[model samples]
Target: MTDWRSDLELITDAARQAGAVAMQHFRQSPEVWWKNEGRSPVSAADYAANAVLETVLRSARPEYGWLSEETEDTSCRLERETLFVIDPIDGTRAFIAGLDTWCVSVAVVHLGKPVAGVLVAPSLDEEFSASEAGEATRNGVPIRVSRHIAGDHLRLAVAEDLLNRLDPLFVRDVERIKHVPSLAYRLAMIADGRIDGTLVKRNAHDWDLAAADLILERAGGSLVDLAGERLVYNRAKVSHDELCAATNADLPRLLRHLGLGLQG
Candidate 1:
């Protein structure tokens, strides 16, 4: 059997290499286009990175199944026990706009759960990774979720819609809210202790949140749906809705505020 650790190392390396390819194209003025009714943007950089990532990963593990945002999906993955789930470039809007918040997100899913994950944000000089049996780390240092209490003093991470829809109680207590275009990076921020928590009502795709979920969970954090349910992966439809991610601080209150109960 192939060593999962070594396989993960290869995946991590591939992700970084792909990130470099993206940065190179990102330096130049690349064509950016819209997809799915302008809900998401795709750039030349995205395809460039996807090509590199797919080539490297497939060569490294020829037997493993493949799933990626920029690649065509196939039913062959259903028969494979292990698969690679990836977003060649998350936050394409940020990338196309010459912003530095995008990243290459990759996850190793075994039996429908992520066993390893890596999120490389080259521009931010940050790489967050986690293994099921190992520690979660940013760069080389260990990281974890914050245990801070949420109140009038706590900061939050959210999209603009949620900010507008939140109850006055939540709005009043949240000391600050930072908008991050990439959901994966936002969850990674929670894992790296950069933010308190993030809430979203939209169903996030498995590829969008898988890597960050493992990173955060291993860092003593949590990624739950509005029902306070753990995020699941390898679904037929790669999208998810109504998810929240945070360090275990004040989670109960946040769920209550959202009128949700803990899920099994």
Candidate 2:
């Protein structure tokens, strides 16, 4: 088997190609379907992109396993040493609504952690990637988390309802940005210093966060559960808790604000 870097090269290209495939159906009114009792939506653009990704990635690394939002899961992948975690078009609603916040998210995991990841947003002309040993990059340029913002001036990206969950003292100190449909892109924004951080609602799956989590980690930040525990992937239980991503300097304050990580 080749090194993880080789897999990074292959998956990054595959993700970009997959983005191209999705863009073709972006605003063409592709078919749509509701899942999880209509609480979630999926579109033909997502499946089209997944097909492109699976063909290219599986062909290049036949020994690896596969898991995707658009494809049925197989217990067989749980037995493999490595697997691909993918969300073909992460923001189906945005894509269907002709918005441009969606992207193709792909990550390779080994031993419960991501070895490499790639996120491609063709419409936005942005591509972000990283490996366990490489710096995070956007469009091939290294990226980093934003500096600490003074109190009362923080720009956070989170659902408005979550704000009410925070301590009123902290809530008054930060400004919330508009909510983004693509959860992956929301995290990516932190990697590029576009936003300070955000709170993730519970029930996010591995495919929704694996790629961008690594990108944010490499760029000097972290995505951790309310307990302030780092996220792990490829587990039998694929869903995550309500998590938050932030730079190291600001994580403690955010965690305290949310009434988490306050005890020893």
Candidate 3:
């Protein structure tokens, strides 16, 4: 098998390069277009960053298949044992709005699991990376999830709708973090101990979670469905259902409070 550590290095570098490309168009009012039936926005920076990531990562790992949000999907990836899954510029809306919460996310998935991943937020000067064989890191320093227990006033980056669904008593003790436009960054926050947990709504695609999922896992956290099953990637259907992310120490309580069964 290929060295997952090396794959992590490869994506970390590629993400950095792609992030730099995106920065050129950030806050510059780069041209924008709509996709997903006009529900989503795509900017020139997204495509430019995608181009850089495609060229750099693919050239270095031609044998690996490719799947990028900016690129059209293809069945060719299904034939390979390993592939690169990318979101050239995650949180395009935030980036276009001149916010610094967006990031360039990239990951290497092998046999339906992420072995390596990187998320670079250029505007924030933050770079998160992890491999199956290594601990999660931000800017080269090892990081882990927060160890806050359930009774504590846990900090959560969650959607308003989801927050309202929880028991009021449970909600009372929780501190709701302001909305973070980037789902990827929000999850990364949990990995680096910035928050206690978050609830992810349905319809999130692989590109949005794959890289950060691995990073969160390496940092002693998990991203799982309501049933507490961990996520799988690179499948025919890339989109995921509602999910929850938190450090292992707090995940069970979060799920319990949400009325979900314990994670297996």
Candidate 4:
């Protein structure tokens, strides 16, 4: 098997370059284009960042298939043993609004699992990464999930609608953090101990979760669906429903508290 640490190094550099491309257009109000009938937005910076990332990542591994938010999708990637799964600018809405929450997200996925991943948020000057060979790290320092979350005040970062759906008693205990625009960054926050957890809405694509999933995993945490299944990468259908990331002891309770698996 190929060493995925080398893949991590390559994607880390590529992610930084992509983040730099996005940063060049940040706060400049780059042209916005709508997808999903204006419900989803893309900007010039997104395309520019995608271009830089594609040039670097694809050039380095031509045989490996590619899946990216900005690129045209082909079923070809499903045939490759390994592939690059990426989101050039994960929080395009935040990027457009000049928020520092956006990130250049990339992951090396092998056989429907992420082996190496990199996330670079240039605006916030943060870089997070992980490989199958090692622990998750931020700027070279190992990071682990903090157990303090289960204490008196549980810091939660989630949508209000989702928060409102939780039990009133549970809500009283949570110290809700303001909205984080990037789902990738939100999970990283949990991994690096910025927040305890977040409620992921449905329809999140693989690119949004793969990198952060590995990071959270190595950080002594997990990002799992309502039924407690681990998130997978590079599936034929790339979207996912609600998931939660927290330390192992906290996850099942969270799933129960949120009423996520009650339907079954």
Residue 253 shift from truth in candidate 3, angstroms: 2.0
C-alpha root-mean-square deviation, each candidate: 2.9, 2.3, 2.5, 1.7
lDDT by residue (tens digit), candidate 3, 1-264:
567887887888899999998999999999999999999999999999999999999999999999999999999999998999999999999999999999999999999999999999999999999988888999999998987654678898877766787778888888999999899999999999999899887799999999999999999999998778998888899999878999898898887866432221
After TM-score superposition, the amount by which residue 183's alpha carbon in candidate 4 deviates from its true location, in angstroms, is 0.4
RMSD of 2: 2.3
**Runs in model 3 with CA error above 4 Å?**
149-151, 259-264
Positional deviation of residue 158's Cα in model 3 after best superposition, in angstroms: 1.7
Looking at model 4, the pairs that clash are none
- How would you encode candidate 1's per-residue C-alpha lDDT over 1-264 as one tens digit per residue? 334677669879999999999989886889888887987788898999999988998887888888999988988888888899999998888888788888999999888888889999999998999888878999979998776653335567866655656677667777556678888898888887777787865656888888888989999888887778886677677787777777776676676665522232
Q: Which stretches of candidate 1 lie over 4 Å from their true place?
A: 1-3, 149-152, 260-264
Q: List, residue by residue over 1-264, the lDDT tens digit for candidate 2.
A: 336788889998999899998988988999999999999999888888999999999999899989898889878889987999999999889999999999999999997889899999999999999999899999999999988644436779867766777677777778799989999999999999988888888899999999999999999999998888998788878898788898877888887776442232
lDDT per model, in order? Answer: 0.82, 0.89, 0.91, 0.88
Instruction: Please give the RMSD of candidate 1 to the true structure.
Output: 2.9
Best by lDDT: 3
Model 3 residue pairs with clashes? none
Evaluation by lDDT, superior candidate among 1 and 3: 3
Poorly placed runs, candidate 2 (over 4 Å) = 1-3, 149-152, 260-264
Clashing pairs in 1: 202-241, 203-240, 203-241, 204-240
